[model samples]
Target chain A: MDLVNQILNSFILFKAAFLILNLILIVFLLVVLQQVFAMSSVITDAFDSGIIRTVAIALLVISVSLFLTALVIL
Target chain B: MPDLFIAPLNKQEEPKQSDDLLMSKSSLPLTELPSNLHLFSSFVANPRGIHFQNQDSDEKVLLFIKRDLITNIVWVGISILFIFIPIIIAVASPFMGNFLNFLPGRHIFFYLLLYYLFVGTYVFVNFFTWYFNIALVTNKRIIDVDFSSLVYKNVAATKLSLVQDVSYDQVGIVRSIFDYGDILVQTAGTLDNFHFEAAPSPENAVHIIQDLIGKEARNGLS
Candidate 1:
C-alpha cells in the first residue's frame, strides 16, 4: 500500500509539471499569435480594426481559459 | 479624317519596323505586353504613360514595378489556405460524416454554410488588402507601396543600380514544378536584403534585373 501511494504521488507531480509546461507553452503561443496578427494587419491593407480587436480579445480569452483549466485539473 | 493624321500615318512605317526589331531583340512575347506599355524617358516602359514623376525627378524612387508573381501567387496562396482550409473542412463535414460518424458538429450542413460565410468574408477582406499594398519594380528604382491596415500607408523606393547581387532559391518538388520561389537581392546599403518569396519565374526575373543593371552601368560609363 505504501509503494502504491508513492507511485500515485509521483504521477500527481508529473501531472502538475505537465500542466505547468502546457500553460507556459499556451501563453507563449498566444503571445506569438498576437504579434503575427498585428504584423498581418500591417502588411495587408484591408484589416478591419474592429475585427482585429475582437479576434485578439478572443485569442487572449481562450489562452487564459486554457491556462486556468490546466491549473485547475492539475 | 484630318491632314495631320494622314501625314503621321504615312511616317509611321519606319516606327513599325523599328518596334518589330526591338520586340524581337527583347524576346518578350507580344501578347504578354502590359496594357500601358509605352517607352518612358529612354528607359523603362510606362504602359499607361501616367507620368507620376519624371525620370530625372527624385520621386523616381517611388516608381517601382514588382514582378506580378509576388502579389498574385505567394500572398494569394497564404490567404486561401489559411482562411479557407478550416471552412472547407467544416462545410464538407456532413458529407464526410455520412461515411464516418465521429464528426464534430450535429448539423453538418448548417455548420458548413456558416463556415462558407466566414471564409467568404475572410477572403474578400484579404483580397483588397493585398491588392493595394504591392509595389512593382521599374528600371530605375524599386517601389514599396504599403497600405498598412486601412488608413496608414508608406510607399518608398530604392535604386536598382545599388543592387549588388541577385540570387534565387527554389526548394522542394512543389516549388520546382510551380516555378515559384525566393528572389534575394543584395544591395549596397544598410538594408539587410530584399527577399521576394515564392515569386514565379525567378530565373527570368533575375536575368531581367541583371540585364538592366548591365545596361545601366554601360550607360553610366558612357
Candidate 2:
C-alpha cells in the first residue's frame, strides 16, 4: 500500500510539472504573439503620425493581462 | 475607278505623312525652331542623355532577402541552453535513483528527445521567418514586408517619386562589424520616416535610391 501511494504521488508530481511547463510555454507564446501583433500594427501604420506606438503599447498591455489571467487559472 | 473608291483613296492620301509636307513648306531656318522642335532637337543632339534616362528608368527595384541571422543565432543559443537541461537531468538522475526510473532511461532519452523537439521547432520558426520577411522595390514603389512572428505580418510601401531623401546610420560598433543598420527614407508628403532596421549595406541602398531619384529628376527636366 505504501509503495502504491508513493508511485501515485510521483505520477501526480510529474503531471503537475508538465502542466506548469505547458503554462510557461503558453505564456511565452502569448507574449511573442503580442509582440508580433504590435509589430504588424507598426508596419501598417508606418505612415501614421503617432498612433502606431500607442497601439503597440496597448497590445502589449492586453497580452500581459491575458497572460496573467491564464497563469491564475493554471 | 468608281467615284466612291477614288474619293476614299484621295482622303487617305491627304493625311499620309503630313509632317514631311509641312517641313517642306516651312522655309524657316532650322536654328529658329519652335520650342517643341527645340526640345526634340536637344533630345536628338544628346543621345547620352536619352540613354542615361533609359537606364535610370530601367533601374532594378531591389528587395532585401531576410536572412534572419539574429533570429537564427538566438534560436541556436536557446537550443544550446536547452541541451544543458538534459545534462542537468542526467546529473540528477543518479541522485534521484529509482524515483525517476519511470522516466525511461532515467531522463536521458527524455531530455535528448525534448532537446531535439525544441531545436526542431526553433529551426522551423526561424526558417519560416526568413522565408517571409522580404523587401520589394520597383520603378514606382518600395515595399517592406516584415514577418516578425508566425501569425503576424507587417507590410509597408512608399512611392519612389515621393521619396525625398534617404539616410543610413550605423551607429554602434556591433552594427558596423555586422554590416547592418537602419535606413531612414524621408518622404516629401509624410511626416513619419520609414525606418528599415538591420538592413545590410544600408549606404549602398541609399546610394541606389539617390541615383534613381537623380535620374527621375533629369528625365522630368528633359
**Model 2 shows how many backbone clashes?**
0
Clashing pairs in 1: B36-B47, B36-B48, B37-B47, B64-B136, B64-B137, B65-B136, B65-B137, B65-B138, B66-B136, B66-B137
For residues B1-222, write the lDDT of model 1, one tens digit per residue.
Answer: 655644444544322222211233443432233334321111123333333322444332212233333335565676678666766765796888654243234233333433444444344344434533444456576555455344465655567778788788988887787666777778887865667655556665566566556655765775
True contacts kept of 2: 0.00
lDDT per residue, candidate 2, B138-217, as tens digits? Answer: 45566666675566676677777777888878888877786667778888864455777666656555665665565556
Docking class for candidate 1 = incorrect
- Looking at model 2, the pairs that clash are none
Give the runs in model 1 whose Cα sits over 4 Å from its true position: A1-74, B1-117, B146-154
lDDT of 2 by residue, A7-37 (tens): 7787567546544544554465455445544
Q: Per-residue lDDT for B150 in model 2?
A: 63
Off by over 4 Å in 2: A12-74, B1-61, B65-72, B91-99, B106-112
